[model samples]
Target: MGTYFIVREIQKDQETGEVRDGEIHFTDSNPYAIAYAEESIANRVIDLLREGTSLNNIREMLQNRHIR
Candidate 1:
C-alpha cells in the first residue's frame, strides 16, 4: 500500500475565529482526497507564480504532483 496523507475539513467559530474541537474526515480512497490534493498543488503553483518562477517549470512540477 502507498502512504497517503489524510485531509479533512474543519469548522471554525465565526466570532472567535477558532478551530472547532473536532474534525470530519472523509472516507479513505475518496475522490475528495484527489481533489484536495490537486487543490493543494494548485495553491503551491500560485505561490511559485508569485515568486516569479517560470510558468513552464511550474507546469512541469504540477505534472509530477509532488508538492515540496
Candidate 2:
C-alpha cells in the first residue's frame, strides 16, 4: 500500500471540475479561523474518488488555488 495523509476534507472546484483539498482548524497562524470547503464540492470530489479518478489528474484541471 502507498503512504497517505488524512485531512479535514476533500473538496472540488465548480468552475474547473477539479478535486481540491481542505483542512479546518484554528491554529496559531490562523487563529479564529473557520473556513469549510463547500459541501457540494466535497460531494463532487467524492464522486470522482468513487469513480477511481486520480488526484494528479484533477490537479491538472484546476484554475484556482483550491487544488494545491
Q: Which candidate number maximizes TM-score? A: 1
RMSD for all candidates, in order, please. Answer: 8.7, 15.3
Once superposed on the true structure, which residue ranges of model 2 sit more than 4 Å away at CA? 1-36, 64-68
lDDT of 1 by residue, 1-68 (tens): 33332334557989999995343333336544322334455456556655667767765775776565
The C-alpha TM-scores of every prediction are 0.38, 0.36
Q: Write the residue-wise lDDT of candidate 2 on 1-68 in tens digits.
A: 22122223558899998987564322223333222234444445545555667767544543455542
Count steric clashes of candidate 1.
Answer: 0
lDDT of 1: 0.51
Candidate 2 global lDDT: 0.45
Q: What is candidate 2's CA lDDT for residue 45?
A: 50
10 residues in a row with least lDDT, candidate 2 = 25-34
